[model samples]
Target: MSGDRGAVELEGVTKRFGSMVAVDSVNLSVKPGEFLSLLGPSGCGKTTTLRMLAGFEQPDSGFIRISGEYVQGVPPYKRDVNTVFQHYALFPHMTVAENVAYGLRQKGVPKSEIAAKVAEALDMVQMSKLAERKPRQMSGGQQQRVAVARALVNRPSVLLLDEPLGALDRKLREEMQIELKLLQSRLGITFIFVTHDQEEAMSMSDRIAIMLDGHIEQLGEPETVYEHPSSAFVAGFIGRNNFWQGVATEHGIRADDGTEFVASRPEEDVPNGQPALAAVRPECINLSAERPADSNNVTAGVVAGVSHFGDVLQYVVSVKDRDLLVLTPRAHAARFQQDDNVFCHWSADDVYLFSARQADIVMTDGDEEIHDN
Candidate 1:
């Protein structure tokens, strides 16, 4: 490992499994101490990419570099990286301190050095008090911390986390997210996290590479990818969106239902008259009793359902043949009720227009469901 900084680079990397192409030609550059996430649904090749980076799986083509050195044939133990899997994978019989000291002991470090390093690692994760407790006696969160400590004991330049928080309950997972982020910031080590949860990626990643069908569909900061998606798939996957299939127009799109979308800036070009999709995020659509003067982006609907989520309220409005999801601040959400007539309107700036290349992936059979951020 280069002691200066942990910089990783993947150039035109490709991986295959028999007849299946798990990861397409992918290029990524991660700066030292940066937190980057490989985010996508199951079977999108996120885990494969992470495995390749950890040296557990070699790429079929292209090359990988770690800390400025090409690591094409380097084995997992030889690479300057360590991985924490979804399962804690701690030895059940080993105490917390013993578990953390296993790696150093395997490498034949001095007993005095191993003890000091084990204590430091346990202290880093606030698990020092549980150093004498076996994995079977500790809580899930504590076991997770031990797993992290074991990885950190090696002091790898880059840490690969594959859904490390996936096993915990929602609340504990959220708490771990904060701790892990703070830990990364404190250590200044490069972290490459992989997960299928969009919200997790958005909250933890400095930049996210959203993969789909073995290739990265888009790569950007959370806000950039959410507000200005490169493709229809990204717009739908990053967050909840109400999509309207339509034909591209000079300004925006004309929905098949006759609704017009005049976007100030379209995310993609569709050669005017080509099939396209126009999307608006749930929070962008405002519900009102009176229709706005601007007719281009206004439509009528009936409130089909309402769901309260602490400070936010989500509404399912039935419009013609489809249901549109809208989110509003709870303080401002009392005006509408189920079966009430309402007008849904949005600003052109909030509209996102894209070519319908990935419409099949975005559009589902039922109404789009809303998930809390």
Candidate 2:
């Protein structure tokens, strides 16, 4: 640690297991006190990358620096970093305070100092009231808070989290997300969080590195990644979109479904007449019973489903053997129903076009992780 609060850098980092390349040529930098996230599907090497940072696993190639200091072979304990895993590995027999104080005692800190730090850490996480309770006596969320306190008790420059909220239910997980983000902001600690959950990463991180098989596909802020995807895979994974297989044309692309799309914002350059793909987000689409006379971007479909999400209404419309997802604000009058004929339309500015190079890859919203390797 270079006396700086927090900073991390990876240069050409690559990790391999036998014949498999877990991570390939990864390069990233995190500012001091920044909250960064490694987000991707399982087997995309996010956990492996975090493990390398924690010193639990070593990289075959590249450099890693913590607070401007190269930590090639420094042990986990010696490095200026702490890890909080999904499972709260607290001692079942020890009280919360005891569990937090164990690290300080192992380092031979004075009993007086350990007591003060333990109290401070527990209070920081709002768990001071449960200091006397054992892990078995606490709720799942409470135990998780204790685990976080235990990690913070060490006061490491950087904190690495691996799906710390994975085991919690939806409501609890969301609540903890807000709490943990606030905690990191208050402490001004550099947090390197690893998660396969897109919404979690989008909600918490200052910047997100979206990974794919052995490599990073894109890196940007949440809004940037969501609004302007760099590739077809990114457009599909960052959120939901209606995709069209097509061939690039002079203005935009001609869809396989016979819908011609003209994107005012084509992110990728493709040769005219070449294979291509176009995508439009559900919120960008409008549904009407009357078909537009214009041919810019319009399609006829039958509403297959309607779902209310409090603030928004989502509809699945089937058109020409393919289903398109559309979202409308709840403030708008609900005008469509299941099996009703509808026309969907979007402006050219709302369309995004991508090269067909990534058309063959199947993107599944990061619901599965490749843990076998």
Candidate 3:
């Protein structure tokens, strides 16, 4: 592995599996030392894209560049990158130190140098104390740390993580997320992480490439993608949203459910009377006992259910034939009970209006799903 700048680039990359295109003609540029995440649902080509970068899968068209060098025919071991898969894939019979040294030994590295590198890698992941433990004897989180250490031992310019923390319990996964981020920052190594979990991507990535149907749907920082999604699919996938199918109007959309929206900041411009989709985030909606005076972006509903999260309250309001999710901070929640009449209102600025091109793909029930384009 070379100590070069870890910038990566993909130019018009495409891959097909028996006529099923896994990665369409896609282009991307990753900056050196940047933590970028490839995020999307299953079959959205995020993993395929990672494989191509790792030299495990070659693109049928286009090309990839790692550390400023073309890697079209490069083998996995020859590439200046290391991959940490969802499964740690550690040698069950080997001690943590031996497992981390396996790659170095295979490459004919001197035993003296390998030991020093292995010790340093284990220390980096805080696994130095457990260097002699076998995989079967250690906890999942501890084993994962060893796996990371093994990858880091080679000193690759770029590290690729494919849902590396997916196997851990929620609390442990969160703990690893913070630890990995801090480690990446300290190492100043470019990390390309692949995960379908939006929260993981949002929390750990400096920028996220939201893939859809073999292409990049949106690429931006966590806040940029969440606050201003490029499409309805991106919006729905990034967070909980209430979507309405309707026709575009001068000011906004008039939903088929008879509710009207006035979006001062519509994401797309749809000509009047054309089909469109309107979206409002759960936290953006406000619930009140009295109807709002404003005419637009307000609807009468009855509280269908209420659930309490640690610091927030979730309310399911039934308006017409649909249920809208509303999230409020516990400190400011009005404490509406089930079956209580309430009004759901949002500001025009809070509404996201887009063309109905993705109407069939948008999950109206607040579920995250990205269908094939």
Top lDDT: which candidate number? 3
RMSD of each: 2.9, 2.8, 2.1
List where candidate 1 sits over 4 angstroms from the true fold: 1-4, 363-373
Per-residue lDDT of model 3, residues 1-373, tens digit only? 2544799999999999998999999999999999999998888998889999999998999989999899989899999999999999999999999999999999999988999999999999999999988899999999999999999999998999998998999999999999999999999999999998899999999999999999999999999999999999898889778888889999999998787789899998889999888889999999999878987788999999999999999999999988889999999947899999999999999989999898777753235443312
When 1 and 3 are scored with lDDT, the better candidate is: 3
Q: What lDDT score belongs to each candidate, Candidate 1 first?
A: 0.90, 0.89, 0.91
The backbone clash count of each candidate, in order, is 0, 3, 0
- TM-score of candidate 2 relative to the true fold: 0.96
Candidate 3 lDDT for residue 156? 92
Candidate 2 local lDDT, 247-366, one digit each (tens): 999889898878788888898987899988888889999998888877789889999999989998999999997788899998987578899999999999999999877776636366
Model 3 residue pairs with clashes: none
lDDT of 2 at 43: 87
Off by over 4 Å in 3: 1-4, 364-373
Task: Output the number of the TM-score-best candidate.
Answer: 3
